[model samples]
Target: MTTATETLLPGTDIVLEQLPKVSLHDHLDGGLRPQTIIDLAAGIGLELPASTAEELGAWFAEKSNSGSLVEYLKTFDITTAVMQTAEGLRRVAHEFVLDLAADGVIWGEIRWAPEQHQQKGLSLDEAVEAVQAGLDDGVAEARADGRTIRVGQLISAMRHADRGLEIAELAVRHRHAGVVGFDIAGAEAGFPAGRMRDAFDHLAQSFFPATVHAGEADGLDSIRGALLDGRALRLGHGVRLAEDIEISTENGTSYARLGELAEWIKDRRICLETSPSSNLQTGAIAQWGDEMVDHPLDLFYQLGFLVTVNTDNRLMSGTTLSRELALVSDAFGYDLDDVLTLQLNAASAAFLSVDDRETLTDAIIAGFEPFLDAEDAR
Candidate 1:
């Protein structure tokens, strides 16, 4: 059995690392270990910004904290460079699942662009198959070690490119294999989801789930585009959707007034995948403030915005699922119930079959029961 000693909750005795977690917005290339990068780069003869793994890790953090989305994306250039081969993709995908299991994640949706990995002569289908094989290996390995985990791939199309329709087809074709969803990622500021209307239309016709990257590098309009055009089942880092909300105080009581878009999203229970540390580093919440406490996560949670926590880029943010929950709990003074509610929200929003989702919910409840019982006993 895994003990919670790995992650002691801040200002509490709770061993948070033992709790089950679900990751919805982690990028495959964004979660590679520094050592893996060094090894892969060596194989590809790729020069790195830093030689040692420790310095490379530090380099990723520093570059991501540059506060410019374009600059932040440059870090992926290094990660993606070495991931162009079948072996590279498989190894990274396998390690990604193992790392998620180590962080107490019971389920995760790994998103990556297949078109980006075609540079080494592998077709789109070959890339997906290689990654799926690796994920299967990781799952078997984790289960052998007594950690239960399941993962799904979210095949992503680069928003800057014109392969949306093709990627959508690819994702749908691989639905029975390992792909559970489709997404549009990369350079979100200028490329609205509307540009891929045909792809979104096709996905809707095929009844495929999609989570669009929005409101992270852009504002409310981008979020609007994601919903109206992409028909997204979930929002990828939709933290900036809070910009449409107006907060006021009356008689010493604070209240939030939602705009039409914000009201629709809240009423519809559209999941907003919010990553606190990454949002801070990328200036996604700059208009509100410059700290975790200033993040609109608490506000959205309080307002019933279907908010779910995520580690957008674990390597870049130097974080884990447990760490994200701990940071948010400490910042917002959340209790065990609040934490469990967030996990349940994520479970409900996961891109799995209804039966599979129910099973996952059961597992979550089962896993958290002992901790809750201990808390109540205290």
Candidate 2:
């Protein structure tokens, strides 16, 4: 049962929170409950900008809304600070899954850089293990509550750091455990994925899947490196790829011409893990406009790009997958079919095996059937 606070699909009585959703770009550290942060901070002797949960949540939201990716990223210092110990990582990971489940996410990939959580002597492997344990606990708890949710770790390496190869190996070593894929994130403008060629090469040789953070803080060149060097299966916040598209108005009709880069991404069906609220907060969509309507997500969808909506940082953005979908629906006038298409796109792009992907796709279709039937009846 969804609460009054649950987001409803625009122009429909259906609760968006009850829809089957898939999250591909959510951050474990960025999804913690504000009270959990306070509790963990007290244990670790860390000072936070706000004391109460409400204030802390608002502080994160305000700090993240600075409209600069750099400024938006500064809020992570507070989040990652409290996530040093195994206990802290576990609790945060556990709660992260529960939150995703509560938001009606049936499958989610929680991405985070393990190297950043070693301030308290936890090894990289230990950090991954701790998070996996927490995810497992959360899954069990969710199942007990009759919520079916599955989660995987997308272990990330900081782009500004030189530990890409090391992190890649760690991710591969734990593939059979809870880790699903690998990624390179953080400060995308200067540090291109080419810098992590060795890591990508290793992942490719090992036949592991990867998604590179590109086209968010950078442009086409960065996205090119992600595909060419990193061999990314998906592009994280690939919103800027829209820059390669030229829209011109001739007569009363407007047409879009795709550049070679945009053409290739579109032709190949590479997934775009777009975070609507976080994209706005980070100024990722400022080139088009500052409003949700200005988001190229609708343009991308109209052009048949494999786009999936996500909540990059729920705490900072004060959003959920359901909320992200509802925002896009409201902005683009997307109905139930559009929403289902987005979920299907995400299900297909998930780092699961072909059979697993089919299973997920079936589950998503099944979940949306009743709603679609109800819409038809109406």
- The numbered model that scores best in TM-score is 2
Which candidate ranks first by lDDT, i.e. highest?
2
Off by over 4 Å in 2: 1-4
* C-alpha positional error of residue 208 in candidate 1 after TM-score superposition, expressed in Å: 0.2
* Candidate 1 displacement at residue 218 in angstroms: 1.0
Q: Considering summed lDDT, which 10 consecutive residues are worst modelled in model 1?
A: 1-10
| Per-residue alpha-carbon lDDT of candidate 2 for residues 185-222, written as tens digits (9 for 90 to 100) | 88899999999999999999999999999999888999
* Global lDDT of each candidate: 0.93, 0.94
Please give the distance, in angstroms, between residue 333's alpha carbon in candidate 2 and its true position after superposition: 0.3
Q: Extract clashing residue pairs from model 2.
A: none
- Candidate 1 lDDT over residue span 265-314, tens digit each: 99999999999999999888898899899999999999988999999899
Error of 2 at 169 (Å): 0.4
